[model samples]
Target: MFKKEITAGAKSKVKSSVQRGIRTKVVETYPLLAPHIDEIIPKKSQLDLLKLPDRVSLYALNNEPLFWQHMDDAIVPHLRVVHQFPHCFSRIGIDRGAIRFVLSGAALMVPGLTSAGGQLPEPEGQLKEGDVAVIMAEGKEEACMVGQLKMGTEDMKEKKKGVAIDGGHCLGDGLWKMSID
Candidate 1:
């Protein structure tokens, strides 16, 4: 949602109980991260919550941003944070042609993802509609966007020309450029 470089101000330290709750929600959402919870958010580390424009909430450790949520939506990890554990989340690859549009904060269309240049989860995989997905560009080593799927793999395969993913955090979006400090 962040299109401009917005400044995050007035951060408040999250209470231990609330921090634990955030940890629980994160672990529940990404089961693979369960084992790394302590390392990701140590009990002694100070966790602060910063409210941004458009009802977004950011959680950070020191000056490093860890994750954010838009309104009551699912928490999405920052690209820098997700880079630390690349394989933890499900992924979808878009064609090279769509990279620029995605970086510009456009909604991902099904055609770009269903084309020959794209890659989707295998039919038997558990990836479902509404799951958080890491959007990778063709031939890129790092993920370009973090978003929630609007349709399941099977459905995308059948109906291949509509919006496939909703609002996403991209490489140069305000969220990515925002300073937590």
Candidate 2:
């Protein structure tokens, strides 16, 4: 994985977008973003959000988000991925940066060998509903939900105020007491 430095202003914008569950436009003028459009965008639905010509990732959420409650243990070596959803997703092994691609309706997210270093030679596993995917970066082990996508602190703050009115989701694990706002 390539590491790049982001300016404070850009970071703030990204944070604001993620916090608001809004998509930010990638600025094509940035020197570092011209080569990775395809990698950052894998789906047609995400194309419109790329209007700025820069790569963008999710920044935030507005609704009660749902994640797999017990997804940490399913990791395995050379596991075959079977798709089970309409969207494309990946089950990435953290330590090796091996990525398994799946279309909807494929079986559990699993890994397959490829010659592209870490990239999958061919997409396997069709995506489908109720499918759980784990993504990890290179040189990393042990997966947790970590993506550049995030929400803005302002949105989180607003959501926190709604908690008293019974409308916010839990921000932390154990006792759904904390809200993101």
Candidate 3:
């Protein structure tokens, strides 16, 4: 969703109760993050909220972006968060050819995931539409982007065309370049 180099509107300290709610919701959405939850968001730590354009709210700690949610939808972790706990999230890799486009903030295409250089969950049916996933590249060791799947893996295998991930935060997108300070 953070395509352009947008500006952060406000920075406010999140209330303890609200912070607890966000922490719970984040763990619920990403259960694998449970073990490192404390390290990711300490119980007594103060979290800050950065309001971005388009109703996107970014949660940060120690001037580092942690998680963000658009409206009341799923709370997606930042790429940095995913990188730190790479094994804790569902991942899909794109071909080398797709890397540039993804870094440029383009909608990920199906072929990028179905191609020989790409890699998806072993079974085409493992993932469903709207699932949040980390976008990895063919030769990269770290995730390049985080986004919600526009279509299921099964559908992508069958159709082999069209958008796979829409409006994701990429490695070089505005959000990635944005500083919490």
Candidate 4:
């Protein structure tokens, strides 16, 4: 599915444009950050994002949690793998809609739970043995799930000796959730 489809100059221009867009969007969304936006730009650089080594890079982006509570259902934001590892798992907590490729492993996500069903949907279908499991976001005190996910255990573990992710089961929507990062 991957193929060369763009020229070097075009690629460079597109990359620069996207970087500027991210900077502008972040600054506008967080006005309080207007003062030091310049300094943050270099750190938030997305250059060679497609060339970065296989791994999930977590950035607080100024000590402020990068995760946001998405409420606009009409807006479905697509999250391509800007960076990732082969067997690595990404523990993403999306308050909004998200989509990613199943790169060998699975992606674990648990949204806030409101009630029994809450905002999240229950697991369904016959999940394959090594099939990637994605736990959608739900309300705070209602989401309940228990399943065996290869990546969860790795994502939860403090450090993986030979593994790249910690595999484990998650209960309620905690402040911080683990993933195959």
What tens-digit string does per-residue lDDT give for candidate 2 at 1-181?
Answer: 0022222112112233332222122212112332442333322322111101123221212211211111222111111111111123343322243222111111212222121232221234332222233333345443322121122223322332211111111112121221222
Off by over 4 Å in 1: none
Q: What is the C-alpha RMSD, rounded to one decimal, of candidate 1?
A: 1.2
Choose 3 or 4, whichever is better by lDDT.
Answer: 3
Against the hidden true structure, what lDDT does model 4 obtain? Answer: 0.29
Q: lDDT scores for all predictions?
A: 0.87, 0.23, 0.90, 0.29
lDDT of 4 at 153: 33
Rank by TM-score (best first): 3, 1, 4, 2
Best-matching candidate per TM-score: 3
TM-scores of the candidates in the order shown: 0.95, 0.21, 0.96, 0.23
Whole-model lDDT for model 2 versus the true structure? 0.23
TM-score of model 2 (CA atoms)? 0.21
Give the Å shift of residue 154 in candidate 3.
1.2
Clashing pairs for predicted structure model 1, backbone only: none
Clashes of each: 0, 39, 1, 25
In candidate 3 the C-alpha lDDT for residue 167 amounts to 85
Q: Tell me which of candidates 1 and 3 scores higher on TM-score.
A: 3
